[model samples]
Target chain A: MSGTSAPATAHGPHHAGPYNPAKGRLGMWLFICTEVLLFGGLFLLYAVYRYRYAEAFHAASGLLDRLFGTANTIVLITSSLTVVLAIFEFERGKPTRARNYLLFTLLCGLAFLVIKSFEWGAKFEHGLYPNAPHLMSMGFGEILYFGLYFTMTGLHAIHVIVGMSVLFVAWRRIGKGTLMRTRPAFLENGGLFWHLVDVIWIFLFPLFYLIS
Target chain B: MAETAAHAGAYGEGPYFNPETVKPGPAGWLTTTNHKRIGVMYLSLIATFFSVAVILGLLMRIELMYPGQQIMSAKVFNAMFTLHGVIQIFLVVIPGIPTIFGNFSLPTLIGANDMAFPKLNLFTFYLFVAGAALAIGSCFTGGGAPDTGWTFYVPFSLKTAVNVPLATFAVFVLGMSSILTGVNIVSTVHTLRAPGMDFGKMPLSVWGLYSTAWVQILATPIIGITMLLIVVERIFGIGVFDPTKGGDPLLYQHLFWIYSHPAVYIMILPAMGIMSDLFPVFSRKNIFGYKMIAFSSLAIASVGSLVWGHHMYVNGQSDTAGIIFSLLTFLVAVPSAIKVVNWLATMYKGSIRVEAPFLYALSFVWLFTIGGLTGMFLGGLSTDVPLHDTYFVVGHFHYIIFGGTGFGIFAALYYWFPKLTGRMYEKRFAIVAWLTTFVGFNVFYFPYFVMGWQGMPRRYFDFPAKFTELQVVSSIGSYIMVIGIAMIIGNLLRGAKKGEKAPDNPWQGATLDWSLPSPAPLENWDVPPTVTRGPYEFNHSEDDK
Candidate 1:
């Protein structure tokens, strides 16, 4: 790492743009690396609990909507593709095409959220919310299992919403010619983040939907 | 923008004290991309929090003057300790180096014009402020400040009377700020090095921060997510940590410590970096084992992460897990020993000067040695079981955190004060403050180590009269230490205008920071610097003057 401080003696301050866009993108990618570790830590917690209370987790997983989670996973992965394609459009100097791709990605993000709301609604209707009165009534393991699932997946959904908003803003910026030149780092970084969101869902799909 | 105007040299430059030099009040400070300004802003916030927490600490001391709830109710005492922990950990110590000195000096030391992302740097400062606001604001909410202690142990945290969710939310935001700053610095170090300054050629301070930044990036997220989970548990009644709904409170401790223990390294590694810089400069010698010190930082960061379970030895961790944690915990001490030995060896046979920063660094060595050795005593399961959560653990950490990290901060402040403010503080005043602080610090925390060994539990308002004498001495010592703190602040504030002028390189140090004027120009460097002499080249210069 370059020392964060300035050199003691040098000719003049301004150098040819110390801000390299590619490195900027790389910095964001590195940020997601940490985010992955963070989520990985939480996932480890889930895994250990699942191992310890496999019957409970499995039964709890049965309560979650398998079709809804699978559908949302597909929606997110599809959005991830569009984001990549949008970056590709920008790389090829096709701003209009990139805008269309970004729009599609944003739409997919919104759709995923919409489906998530539906799933949450179902859970709420079924008294499956976290720490619901019926939680302990079901059994200790089952309550613990559902608790981890809701906390993990709910937090993941919040991130998706945040990711979607960032992308929507980037989409508008691209159309305004702000991102047309030099391939917007915003679009690139946003794509990386969207992909992370997708990757989290990929893990979530099996844990919440497929395993049971 | 206007690069030329910002790049003027010594006589060619404008007046030494430009009206524009000090950031223009609140708005200028809020929007400042200037690292020095941001450093000052962070220090100001830290000081504010420190003052509040210190008052709370003093009150806790007074409450313990008798035995059972003398001045306040048990509930209030709980809040006091909780406030003290939260303020010290989240508000002050965690941001100790990086936000203050790291922000101000990191870009300057590297011979860069500014941080790789100046705007993002500003955002970090703002984020910290916002988080602090949220955290402190929770105190006034209907439910009152959180009483979960800084650890926010689950079950209690989720079921506490306080508005813990809001407090946890604040912690979440503050954590993000820390992670972002870490990422920014890592990238800055990666992308913005001056020419000829490769990884091995960098200064020790940079090395320390680089390791710290990685810890912040990697470990902070676990804590962030953990805090978020607590909030979720509280708000939505998630059973993740709630005992009634199959949640295990033990899991919360595991997750919390996973980040929190590594966090202890985050707090001290940069300070160690500060000592690494101060030791050689004040000693007027080459560092003893430059690579060892650099690599030990990484060692501490990695090994530190694996030892969080040590905190749980007495808290009900499985014996196998405890053994693994104990082994890893012992491993951490080796790197710490390497650092201690290397620093002492650096001072041997060297032309050492007793400057204020050097005094603090020396104290850091002496006190951190005490802290580290005592830690070895506790690392063994036999001793820890008896003394866990007693005054011993409290004293052990204070020695490390206060004696180690706190002294390191003072050393850094004295070392870089001139660079940040363009003024030389009173040497005698600084020295006097250091003496009292060093003496009072030992007097204060040393007894706790003894009382802890004697089986005095921590956080109790009243104890047996047998422990009273030491408690009284510790309380008196606390006052002396506070006075010392007051003197240090007084010297800095009074010296800002009344002090003498500092040369660009007052210590004649060889680091890149000495190459620039104090209160560096709007832009950092005229051009990126090239490295010629190695980081440890005290003997290379024949002209000592």
Candidate 2:
């Protein structure tokens, strides 16, 4: 691992030899890009379905709590900022401060999940489970629209839970002062994953709560 | 003074092992970014999954022993087939050789100290485990496991009563893990090779993984996306593939195959690379056309992508698409044939040792040749009409996957177990296991070809009395294959604990993996190694007897 470090070059002409963190990050980014494409296919399905059942989707969109959706959006965006700041704090060698911000980010993730569960609870109370034969009484397009809304959002919620766990790990490591400090790769990687979860919500919020 | 000494930390002792530990122990495994450790974890877990699916496969054969459902209900049968397909494809075949062997050894083969991103490598392992948990969790969910097959084709997939969403989500996560590993490997090979190790000097194993890496990076997304869309459709009544919503069902097939087609080569090309490595070492000769074998891997990966359309040929695709896919599929075969020819030529007029790895490799040539030729039979439109959805297709792919890739994996395992474990297996038992596997494999699958020709459809728990005899033969073959697998497990597990100590370069191979101390150092290479010769140069060894 010891070699001529790439001259402390700031974004130097993309070093061709030896390991580069920039290249590693770019590789991770490219990987995330593939994820986007993977998720894009499902979005394509969402778009097609939305177009076909616009009336029903619009009606189902009405059933969602826009206030809670908007609140969760703000919570996620704020948490993303908090996570980015934690990275900056770690970069500045303030491990204790970084730990606090990471903890905050974790709390925000938890809050979002809590809100989502309540929202899901309400839907379950209404017997909105997917493919419920009784859902046909809700209108054909509405039945299909709510089905997708529940599925997409449900998957996204699972992602939120996963993201929270990742952030929690970072938080604990920062608290212990044993986090790899020479490079803030863990924070950065966790940040990347968190942003992906955030980005998924950016798509899901509109599809499920604002499609009309 | 004594109390202070009791609390005093030793140079090596700690409450827990940090990533810095190079020695083999529990701590080294948990947090180590060493590619080899990560690779071992991948291979070990995947082997467990493989064993489970193999049992399921045998059960399937057993169930078909009688005309009607004897061992299980129709529902259980459906779940069995679905579980078998899903588990083997994602949990075993996809990661079997690549993440396990490729991740562990590719860096070593190219003389790199570690992957370009070691942390990412560890992360991929965790992701794989998480995905696996989700998949296993689906089995216990209220509705039962997903039964739409591995492809999870729409309509049925969307309407399935099982926890299909959970399983699909698991696959989606696993695919991401695969993509990240691909990115890590590709970049590592591009930027991490030793100074003298040019792309041409890179071993064919590296080449094979490098080729398959892009398929994982690029092709996996299509399936990832398709699986997600199905989840969306099922939950939201998304009309993308629903006829009621003006969506086209056929498009699902299109996107699914776009990724799944190239996935076939992803499963095989690494095995070919393993064969290429073994061929020259055992023959005590330089590969006859090293460059050809290396480039053929690329040729196979590139052409393999364009041929996904072949899987959809009989599913109402346009004739032009069919023709294009057929021709390209046929074109991909040429490189494979070139590889076989070159491997044969390497063995000609030279010292040949039928060692365990080489025996497996040799069987790969025979089995893969049959698998490859039968693939041609399925690729052509005229011939495919009769074989599509029949046992013939099942037999053909099983040959390629189980016989070819699976055997190739065993070859690599036997070849590298020494380097990984610093121990040698019992030679006679290994050969017996290989022969048993080889013989039992052909017996189990070859008859399916005959039944396939007789218009017997696959995924059936019940069959006509006429097909009963062949079913019996196939079931017997399954038992034989099971014993063969048992022999392998016994040989390897016992050998790891009690086998003879292996020399660093037991096979007198020239690859960088053997350049280090046996079982590898904690850092893989204590000092970065410089490549001095091409990977296949047999006589370049100064210590060769």
DockQ of each: 0.49, 0.18
Number of the predicted model whose TM-score against the real structure is largest? 1
After superposing candidate 1 on the true structure, give the runs of residues whose Cα lies further than 4 Å from its correct spot: A1-16, A133-136, B1-25, B68-70, B539-544
Fraction of true A-B contacts recovered by candidate 2: 0.27
- Every prediction: chain A TM-score: 0.89, 0.86
Model 1 chain A weakest 10-residue run by lDDT: A7-16
Question: On residues B1-545, what C-alpha lDDT tens digit does candidate 2 reach at each position?
Answer: 01112212321222112344554567668777767778888988998999999999988888998698778887888889989998999899887888988777887787665677778788888999999999888877959988888888877887778989999889988988888888987777766776567777888888889889888987899888787777767666645667665556788988888889888988998889888999988999888898889888989998888888888888898999899989998999999999999999999997998899999999999999998999999999999998999999999999999989999999999999887777899999999998888889998999999999999998887899999999999889889999999999889988888999998688888777776656665454323455557887766664356
Query: Against the true structure, candidate 2 has what lDDT?
Result: 0.81
If scored against the real structure, what TM-score would every candidate get? 0.95, 0.79
Clashing residue pairs in candidate 2 (N, C-alpha, C atoms within 3 angstroms): A144-B236, A147-B235, A147-B236, A148-B235, A148-B236
Measured with C-alpha atoms, the lDDT of residue B195 in candidate 1 is: 69
> What fraction of the correct interface contacts does each predicted structure contain?
0.56, 0.27
Docking class of 1: acceptable
Model 2 spans with C-alpha error above 4 angstroms: A1-19, A39-212, B1-25
Q: List, residue by residue over A1-212, the lDDT tens digit for candidate 2.
A: 11221221111111223435665575767677776766666676677667777887788889888999999999999999999999998998888888889889888999998998898888778877665555656665776676567666776788788888888888888777767777667678889989998999887887788865
lDDT of 1 by residue, B268-365 (tens): 99999989988888888889999899999999999998999988888888899988889999999999999999999999998888899999999999
